[model samples]
Target: MTLHEITYTIKDIQGKGKGLFAARDIKRGECILSEAPLVYVTSNLQEALKSIFVLSKKNAKYFYALCNVHHDISFEFGIMKTNSFPLGQGSTDAAIFRVSSRINHSCDPNVHQSWNPKTKKGHVHASKNIKKGDEILKNYIPILQIQEDRKRLLQENFKFDCRCSACTKPSSERDLIITKVNICTGLVKESAESDPATAIQYVREVLGLLDKIGGICKTSYYYDGYQISAMCSDYSLAQEWANLLLESYQIDE
Candidate 1:
């Protein structure tokens, strides 16, 4: 389907520094409008590919061909390069299309992306009730990071310095976010090697952080729950958290 035909609407997002797709109506999970190529190369000859920006003639031709077949190719490719999440072992050679990308990056985001390789798609769902005009956002990196690191990564990759809530907050508040993130990270790490009692303590601490930050750190809570459940060898609990994560973010199983 064409971009214009899709259920979502493309609209200008403030502070995001780009136009983004927003839902015009409620949409369910696993709804596929388009599947973007993970990597497009013009030349099968690897030597011909030099920079990431320059699509080789062969790849460009392929993209053009796809554009002919798919009306949304240009929009797909534009969003793919701009917001697609990297996949594979390394080098970000592969990417997945996601609504979370449209939401832009925030140190504290209200939505998150969960990739399902089985379906070759990434699902974007709300971490909270997002008002009609609220700019949907996802953390480009782990939510638990110092503002400096978050700013640095977003600037380097997205090419725009973030002006999200956490980024624009006073230095004291930013440090609080960082400190909470650190506490969560430390708890998760220590839980990996410690006794169950210690691990549970860490889990509680992480959950405390989650309560403090609200929806912005939903992904962190989801991950922590999954890890703790797995450590206890409780697949059911793990599955529960996994489902919670998927449901909260509209992730595809």
Candidate 2:
């Protein structure tokens, strides 16, 4: 939809504004859409503003559809600030993807978005199975942090309260997950030498927790699995984690 062919269709979500909805049942790790960015800004507020004015009329229409998180700035700047994603982790350039930008945010997002600098294209992949007609989502804030920080960050930037299951989990369950995550990080670290078997189990536990918390974007644990597995000379486990890691990032052959 929206000038590109995707498995999702554009629909107006009542309180959240526009959102992407699955047009069919989408399996986990499936690529929802892949396309070159509509525009690239050198990841600065000033450059983004200038680009908006130069965008062709056709492109401007799509830009206008994006949400304005910062009302204090020019409309164009707000759109860029709110909608643009990084070229890659810690990159200075920002990318605006047409179809993927329409995807709304959920703490427990069903979809994960990744940018490939080589091809200069963005890919949206299903992190979990999405039933037909379900609204597709992407995380606007880092999901790895404690829920409290995640909520504050979302409110500060996106100007919304996150009611996702992760944020609203019962106090006891929330604490347990956070505690497990912290312990597992050390376990994954030690698995490289001290105990590969324990590391695999720890990473699996962490990944399971991540899925329960609706976080599939951070695949570092998969690399944890692959590294530990390979160190232990477990090729089968290493390959399984490698495949999962690639799919999580929407990397294809």
Candidate 3:
């Protein structure tokens, strides 16, 4: 959606500085906003610095207005580190978007953000139903991390302590579930070849654990299901998982 057509608006949140809030009630899987990056950066500091210097006057203003928590670092690098999102998983390249960068963090976020390579734009979709005027939160770190790791990473990288629902509540139960997910995930990979049936069972366990934690991003797990089913020559189950993988991957598209 264009800036004017966006479903969320930037607003000041108490204690959280600036944040994005739903302009109207949004349904699950609905696209909230999509925009091309205002600045692109690589891993190299000097190259990224050059990219910021070359921004248009208006774009430069927008970039400068973004929050930079890394005050101890170079001004340009600090903004890049704080605001940019990786182009994709394991990608060394990242992009800084004007609107998406404004979304604040939550351990249990109501929205999911994805980079659409085909459209060359970043898209944010409602992971669950969001009410009008509610803050549109997104997970800044891996969703499966325990509370302690989540807090440590946020403090070290973003220079803030999170008080989101996930952080404020008791974490023992949550941590246990996440630990189970990691173990099941490892088992899924290990048994996928030699024991396809067992691998499928582990995949379901992982998905169940993720569901218990309100995670809707299960594309990778579905892909593993598909791969193992196909390995065992179960075309029916493989097709089912393939469809699930496709639907999950296209949620933001």
TM-score of every candidate: 0.63, 0.85, 0.95
For model 2, residues 90-156, the per-residue Cα lDDT tens digits are 8889888777888888777887788877877888878789998999988887766677788789989
Please identify model 1 stretches exceeding 4 Å from their true place: 1-7, 13-17, 21-34, 38-84, 88-92, 96-103, 191-193, 218-253
Compose the digit string of candidate 3's lDDT tens values, residues 1-253. 6643658888887777789988888888788888999988887878888988998999999999999999898888899999989999899999999988999999999988899889999999887899989999998898687899999999999999999998899999999999999898999888888889999999998898888888655878998999889888899999999998877776633
lDDT of the structure predicted as candidate 2: 0.78
Off by over 4 Å in 2: 1-6, 169-171, 190-198, 211-218, 232-237, 247-253
Please report the candidate that would top lDDT against the real structure: 3
Q: Give each prediction's root-mean-square deviation over alpha carbons.
A: 7.2, 3.0, 1.6
Give each model's clash number.
Answer: 4, 0, 0
Clashing pairs in 2: none
With a 3 Å backbone cut-off (N, CA, C), the pairs that clash in candidate 3 are: none
lDDT of 1 by residue, 1-253 (tens): 6642443554654544343444544233433234444343222324212333476676554433321112334544443445445543243344533233344566766555555557665555555555444555666676567778777776665667777777787756657755866776676676665665476566667666666666345554677777777878978878987887777555322
Q: What TM-score does candidate 3 get on C-alpha atoms? A: 0.95
Q: Rank the candidates by TM-score, best first.
A: 3, 2, 1
